[model samples]
Target: MYIGIPKEIKNHEYRVGLTPASAHELVAHGHKVFVETHAGEGIGFSDDDYRAAGVEVLATADEVFEKAEMIVKVKEPQAIERARLKPHHTLFTYLHLAPDAEQTHDLIKSGATCIAYETVTDTKGGLPLLAPMSAVAGRMSIQAGAHSLEKAKGGRAVLMGGVPGVEPAKVVVIGGGVVGENAAEMAVGMGAEVVILDRNLDVLRRLAKRFDNRLKTVYSTSKALADHVASADLVVGAVLLPGAAAPKLITRELISTMKKGAVIVDVAIDQGGCAETSKATTHAEPTYIVDGIVHYCVANMPGAVARTSTMALNNATLPYALALADKGTKKALEEDKHLLNGLNVCKGRITCEDVSVALDLPYVPAEDMIKEL
Candidate 1:
């Protein structure tokens, strides 16, 4: 099989799909790997490094996309990238298609096999491929939120971790999954009064035990979320529902109740956000003020720290990539039920139930499509 790695073309996106080490592994398995020029540069891997690993370096994305059977990418295909997709091509990436109708339509029309990393599940119902990047985005949410709270940024001018004599800032994190847990960890480490809310009592209990009262866990309700927003200096929106759009936990009315100059980092922006005012922003211009509240809704938060993000993402995706490349998507997914759940769109049919329901498209069983393939 011929594998292609393209440089991410999304705004402010610097992470590449495959690293030299990944290419090396594929080469060892007798698969031909072609990497777009400068794809690994952002993560400090040179073309020479890929060449040294027995991977061919192509001069343009066109060459890589045109020649490879399977294309591995870091993000969903942007408009320009989508135009390059051809029928029967395999796209393996983090395709968050639930909210992006345009991309979903394009992929379906192209008649390509689209396996979304974000939809892949583990035995425990956790999103396997999204976990690494979620961990990165969750931790960075606090760092970005804290920066947005600085006086220079037109924030409330209060420090998250106050001086010895002053009280610390209050942080409210909505969700108790990977993103929420990491956000809470960062906020607590910064000495802020952190409160995490979720509907899951089991998650809340586990968090309570892990933090040992350093961070507070609350049962999430509309009233509880509204009340917490009023007093929070920093609010992190981290809710998720697999391949569905994130629920709006913080409405425009709720923002009005929050203190003036409060900072909100909506880490769930990739899944259409948990905040009513959230819009995908870029790193170059990451924040905007709405209803006297500052919103940092960079859709690709992990992209800002590409080195750390790329390495972490590769760690999670490499094994799956190997499996798919070795056995083909059909064989691998057929054998691994967990991976079959990752199949979103293949051969002009929608396979994931959540994505189909979110987009109001027909849901076809993955087995039906895999058998044909």
Candidate 2:
């Protein structure tokens, strides 16, 4: 099998799909790995580093995409990269297709087998592949929100961890999953007044025990959410619905009622955001004011911490990637139901029920699709 690693081309994205160590592992398995020139340069992995690991360095992304059977990437393919995709290629990456109709349509037209890292599952029903980046984004949400809360950034000029003479800012996390848990942990560590809202009682209970009364855990309700949002100085939208679009829990009307100059860090922006006013922003210009509320909705929040994110992601993705390379996509996915869940598109057919429903496309079960292939 020939695997390719292309430099990420998203705005301010610096993470490479395969680290030098990861390439070495593939090389050890007797697989040929082609890395785009300087793909890992942003993260301190030089072309010599890749060569030491037995990877061939290609001069252009076009060559890597053209020669490799499988294209490994950190982010979704941009328009040009998508155009380069061929029917024989397998794209293994974080394809957030539920929210982006254009990308989904292009992918369908490409006729390539696309496996989304975000949709892969574990035996315990957690998104194993998406966890690392989610954790990174969750922790960074507080950091970004704190910066956005400065007066110069159109915020209330409130400090997250207030001084002895002043009260701390109130932080409301809208979910109790990985993102919400990490966000709450960071906010509480920073001495903020933190409240977590979730509909799942078990999740809320677990969080309450984890925080040990340091933060408040409220049963999520319309009234409860409204009350929390009204008092919150920073609201972190951490809700998710797997491969589906994130529910708009915080509406435009809700934002209008928020405190003047409040900040909202939408960690769920990659899945179309949990707030009505949220739009994907880039690190170049990460915030914008909406109804007097500041929104930090950078879609690739983990990209800002590329080195850490790349290594962490490689830890999660390497095993599955090897499986695909070793056994081939159809055989590997057919053997592992969890990996099969990652299959969004195969042979131009949408195989993920969530993505199909979200995009109003026809659905084909991964099991059924693979058998036909």
Note the clash tally of each candidate.
0, 0
Q: What are the per-residue Cα lDDT tens digits for candidate 2 across 1-373? A: 9999999999999999999999999999999999999899998999999999999999999999999999999999999999999989999999999999999999989999999999999999999999999999999999999999999999999999999999999999999999999999999999999999999999999998989999999999999999999999999999999999999999999999999999999999999999999999999999999888999999999999999999999999999999999999889998999999999998889999999999899998888888765
User: Candidate 2 clashing pairs?
Assistant: none
| 1-373: candidate 1 lDDT, tens digit per residue | 8999999999889998888998899999999999999998977999999999999999999999999989999999998888888876889999989889999999998888988999888998888899999999999999999999998887999999998999999999999999999999999999999999999999999999999999989999889999998999999999999999888889988998999999999998888998989999999999999988999999899999998998889999989899989998779989998888898999889998888998999999998988877
Q: Rate the local accuracy (lDDT) of all candidates.
A: 0.92, 0.95
Worst 10 residues of 2 by lDDT: 364-373
Report the CA-based lDDT of candidate 2 relative to the real structure.
0.95
Error of 2 at 213 (Å): 0.5
TM-score of 1: 0.99
Model 2 segments beyond 4 Å from truth? none
Q: What TM-score would candidate 2 get against the native?
A: 0.99
